[model samples]
Target: MREISLDRLRTLVAIADCGSFADAARALHLAPPTISLHIADLEERFGAPLLSRKRGQVRPSAVGETLVKYARRLLAEAEQALQDVKRQVEGKGGRVRLGASTGAIANLLPRALELLALHHPGIDLQIAVLTSQETLARLKSGALDVGLVALPQQATDGLTIKRWRRDPVMAFMPAGWKCPARVTPQWLAVRPLILNDSSTRFSRLTAEWFASGGQHPVPRIQLNFTDAIRSLVAAGYGAALLPQEAVAPVQDPRIAMRPLRPALWRELGIAHSAEDIDRPTQHVLDALWSLRLR
Candidate 1:
């Protein structure tokens, strides 16, 4: 069987809606003969007269009513598909897969998400908490669209890593402890320390900072989650070094945040495939960039 053309379906729908062939032709900017031919073709295909004249106004025959009902749904679905494609092209709707650390997602990404909601509410971000290395690997393997990862990462092919933000690594300790104006490697080394896992890039970076001051001390415990580490610090388990977002207003009285004396920093980068970036991903990137520190 031959497939029906969209033009005929559109004409039929318009005529049914307008209640007259002439009105439908005028509404569709088509000739009267074209409208008549559309109904004739539809009736011929289904072997039934589709429209009838009743009380000087046009109406659908019983068979025509059934076909028109189906036609309306099919046309509505087609229109919805067209609109969805247009929204994607306009950067107004689609899913953008992204990866970031728990710290970034907690303290940093909320502002970016707010901006995204205000501007591109139609775009959904699928977030995964992942390490810098895992995020980079997923990006290269085409599993993710964007990534927020620790800085100084080794270069990977087919990926572009843009500098995103730099946050100072601050000492988080129990508020009741005797504190110094600035925590140093020597001061922190002697205390029980909670730090990121040895497998993490930030752990290695912090280790290097300690090594700079001739202090190579093991942490009391190691874990990757930043919030949990902060909790341990509040309980006086030890002082942990972690990044503080400059704009974050800390009001927790259980723990105090102090700057590091040697000026250690936790840097982050945005990674993506070095290809023509799609609009949805680009919008997310723009939102992330809005949180850049200086």
Candidate 2:
């Protein structure tokens, strides 16, 4: 077995950077002979010349260039690991990977993260945007530390679920369309609709809402984004059923948002692996809970 040394790789990089062995030795505070021996050791290990000299300048050979690229990555990862360990020791914090459905991300996550940032500056949050079911699936698969998902969701094994908030679904129509103050599903079903995509739980909930009124109107357009649905409604394409939070931030004058007669609501919740709730995940969850309280 051959041994490849990081010291040799460092010396190789220094030589390439300084353009000469003597300069590299001076830069690394090593003797010139020691630097030469390091390069020689690498050449012997690989059975190839690792560098070439041209007009009194030094650079990596073709194979050496590839090795140097990998060396840089390995060194970087090692340094990062060291820093992570130090942070852990110092109680600086770690990373928490979170997943959320589109509605939750659009409405809830920014304020939740802002609260987290204020209280736990050392913790880093990694976010993935996915549908409610997808977020739960990923959470179960160990791909996510936590998820914000819409409920009345089916509870699978191995999850700790906590109720987050209830965002009422509203009717969005063209401005001055003369709809009732509280629109009924019966009234909404007769109109062409722009709805959430069929794949999402929101879309299913919307469909059920219309179904309860004994009507199923095919949507004129089915989209994944709430903002896009609002835009289409604003353009007079069709009416839409959307979460209140989705429209709360943007007050588009072209659309009139009305509450439902019975007030349809999308229940949202936080889910985590029942087996793994680390300190960072707990901290983020606490931040989210604070936002919900306010």
Candidate 3:
């Protein structure tokens, strides 16, 4: 059986509205013969006389009335669907998935999110906390739209990684310590240390910095979360080497920060699939790029 087209539905509805074929043809901007053919095709498909003539006026049969009622709803929904697609095309509304480290989420992503909301309020961002390796993996598997990842990552196929930010790593210590204005790796090595887990890129960066100073020290404890490491440092448990974000909290009375002498930096990069990026993802990338340090 042939499916009924919306054109035929519209003709039936117009006939019911104007109570005549001539007015429906003018209202639809179609010829009177085309309107008649449209109704004839619809009636033939349903095997029913869809129009009844009474008092020299054209009126819809019961079947035509039922179709007109449902056609109005379908037309309205089609128009709404078109509006939604247009909004997405204009970068006015869409959903984007992003993945980042806990530190990035805590110290960096909020600013980018704020910028995105300020400019593109209709863009819905779904954020996930993940390691750099996990983020890259998800990007390859089509689970993520964009990622804020630790830098110095090797080239990967089907991915585009661009340097995002470089934040100086600093020594975070309990305020009671008589810490120097600038901390050398040797000076920090001798103190009881709390460090990122050995698996993290940050841990490797700190290790290399210590090695450059000819001092290899064992951490008293290792944790994956930067926030947890800072909490331990605030408790005077041990000192930690962590990136000092530009917007990092400055009013913590118990924790003190000092720049590193050799000036080790934790670098971050934006990564996404090499395929053509959609408007929502492009907007998110633009927000992150705006936050990049000069």
**lDDT of all the models against the reference?**
0.89, 0.84, 0.91
Ranked candidates (TM-score, high to low): 1, 3, 2
Which numbered prediction scores highest in TM-score against the true structure? 1
TM-score of 2: 0.72
| RMSD (Å) per prediction | 3.7, 5.6, 3.8
- Clash totals for all models, in order? 0, 0, 0
Give the Å error, residue 276, model 2. 3.8
Report the C-alpha lDDT of model 2 over 61-176, residue by residue, as the tens digit: 99889888988887788789999877755546788899986667776788877877787788889999898888888988989998988787787899988887877788999996
How displaced is residue 56 in candidate 2, in Å?
Answer: 27
Question: Across residues 62-105, which tens digit of lDDT does each residue of candidate 3 receive?
Answer: 88788888988987887888988888888898889999988899
Candidate 3 residue 18 C-alpha distance from true site, Å: 5.9
Local accuracy of candidate 1 as per-residue lDDT tens digits, 35-82: 998889988898889899988789888998887888888889999999
Residue pairs whose backbone atoms clash in candidate 2: none
* TM-scores for every predicted model: 0.77, 0.72, 0.76
Kindly report which residue stretches of model 2 are placed more than 4 angstroms away from their true locations once superposed. 2-79, 88-93
